[model samples]
Target: MKLISTSNYEKLSQQAGEEIISRIKRNPTLNLGLATGSTPTGLYQELIKDHKQHKTSYKEINTFNLDEYIGISKKDRNSYHYFMCEHLFEHIDIPLDQTHIPDGTAKDLDEECSRYEQFINEHGGIDLQILGIGQNGHIGFNEPGTPFDSRTHIIDLAESTRKANSRFFESLDDVPKQAITMGIASIMDSKEIFLLVSGASKAKALATLMNGDVREDFPASALKNHGNVTIFADKDATALL
Candidate 1:
């Protein structure tokens, strides 16, 4: 595990973007794992800017998103599918067919989870995965107490998570109660992991991740067991560290 602290969110995003862009250039066929939420929006913007300014091609890139709300339609504005499209997919040169996100509305969600896991295995797993630590240390909706060895599966969103996400919806009740997320084991399969932590709200979580023991109670701590994980955090997020 490596920690790179920056003065602010923009600087962290820029550094992360440059690294990702360099990786894409070196391996155009990179299997990229993506994350949603406010933390990564700046990084996505940086990618978009570079794609336009330097013509960094994503044409051969294959992207797999982290999670999606279980009860939302893909077209729903609140859905992770729509979030990815709006924030990154629509702006990139990557083929839509090559970008994979779990079907949240699948009739049999368990089957969908299994299929998605199989699909990732077929692609040789993710070369690099982007992650954002939740205020409660969740990763990809794998909330606190999620088993570290778990595979792709459905999870009941923690109440705190729902409350935090309420800002994106009209009300707390509008947030989905459950989601399908790539499990900790699935995430650990990635060749490398890029974790982004910003804002004072996440300072305690980041501190715990940096100094606490490995345990299921803090999902993000699972990364500590991985050989290749880099954390790009801003000063605010690292204050407690």
Candidate 2:
């Protein structure tokens, strides 16, 4: 694991953007694993700027998102699908056909999970994965205590997670209580991983990730077992480290 701490969020986003753009230049058909939420919004904006300014082509890039709320439709504003389209996908040249996100409204969610897992395997796994750690140390929607060996599966959102996400909804009750997320093992399969951390809200979690034992109680600790993990963080997030 490698840690690169920047002075602030903008610098962090710019540096991370450079790394991603370089990778895309090297392999236009790169299979990218993406994450949603505010932590990555800046990075997405930077990518958009690059696309407009330098014409960084994403026409052949294949993107797979990390997770989605179980009860929401793709059109729902809060859905990860909508989030991607708003934040990154629609702005880039990547084809909608090549962008993959788990179907949260599938009648047979178990089958959907299987299909998602198989789809990733068929594409030769993720070449690069971008991740953001939750305040409770969760990755994707894999809350605390999720087995590190787990795969793509359904998860009951932890109370802390739901509360954290409530800001996006009108109220806490409006938040989805369940989600489908790629598991730790699924994430570990990526050839390279970039873990982005920002703001003081994540300071303690980042501290735990750096100092705590490799236990399932703190999900991000699982990254310690991966060989090619690089952490891009801002001073606020790394304050306690």
Candidate 3:
């Protein structure tokens, strides 16, 4: 529940990226968890810059993305897989084979969900997890009512989430109805967590998650129980808080 605000998004992004780089340097083979959203776009850009400057190397790191829209192809512009490659994976030195993103087109989603969580456990769980809060306080697509102890699973997107995410879609109708995401338990298992938020649009959710009660109605509130968590936000995002 710790909060750190910066004068602007760029500096916040850089600081957060530096912290991640330090962790990776401490352990070249760190198991990292990733989140995708407009909030983290700047952070990814800074990481790209770090790689170009030779300040960071992702050669042996392993990444597990938090969620993916179900029923979408990896080639889809709005897919998390596509977004990750466009923003960070493509610019970094991490091998594609070392990254793990949930399959959006799996025929048996239940099996896919089970396997995804199992794979995480086998890989030593996530050492660091990056998260972005939805407008309604959802994290990793685990919208309100998602049990705090749950693991990976399929879920319907809340209306607030759909509206917030629709900016990347042709229309609200084009947004997928469902997604597969790591649950609250899975996220809490991470040794460290970094929650990034930027922009005025996220101010309300950021405020709520930071000061609100620990309840399922605000899914991100569940994060308070984690022993090591850092929340980084730009002024705009921290305005409400």
How many clashes (backbone N, Cα, C below 3 Å) per candidate? 0, 0, 0
Q: Using TM-score as the measure, name the better of candidate 1 and candidate 3.
A: 1
Residue-level lDDT tens digits of model 3 in 9-81: 9988998999988888889999999999987888889889988997588888999999999999999999999
2 or 3, greater by TM-score: 2
**Candidate 1 lDDT by residue in tens digits, 69-117:** 9989989999999999999999989899999999999999999999999
Worst 10 residues of 1 by lDDT: 88-97
Compared to the true structure, candidate 2 yields what TM-score? 0.99
lDDT of all predictions, in order shown? Answer: 0.96, 0.96, 0.91
Which 10-residue window of candidate 3 scores lowest in summed lDDT?
50-59
Q: Which pairs, if any, clash in model 3?
A: none
Task: Compose the digit string of candidate 2's lDDT tens values, residues 190-223.
Answer: 9999999999999999999999999999999999
Deviation in Å, model 3, residue 83 alpha carbon: 0.7
Where model 3 places Cα greater than 4 Å from the true spot, the runs are: none
Compare candidates 1 and 3 on lDDT and give the better one. 1
Off by over 4 Å in 2: none
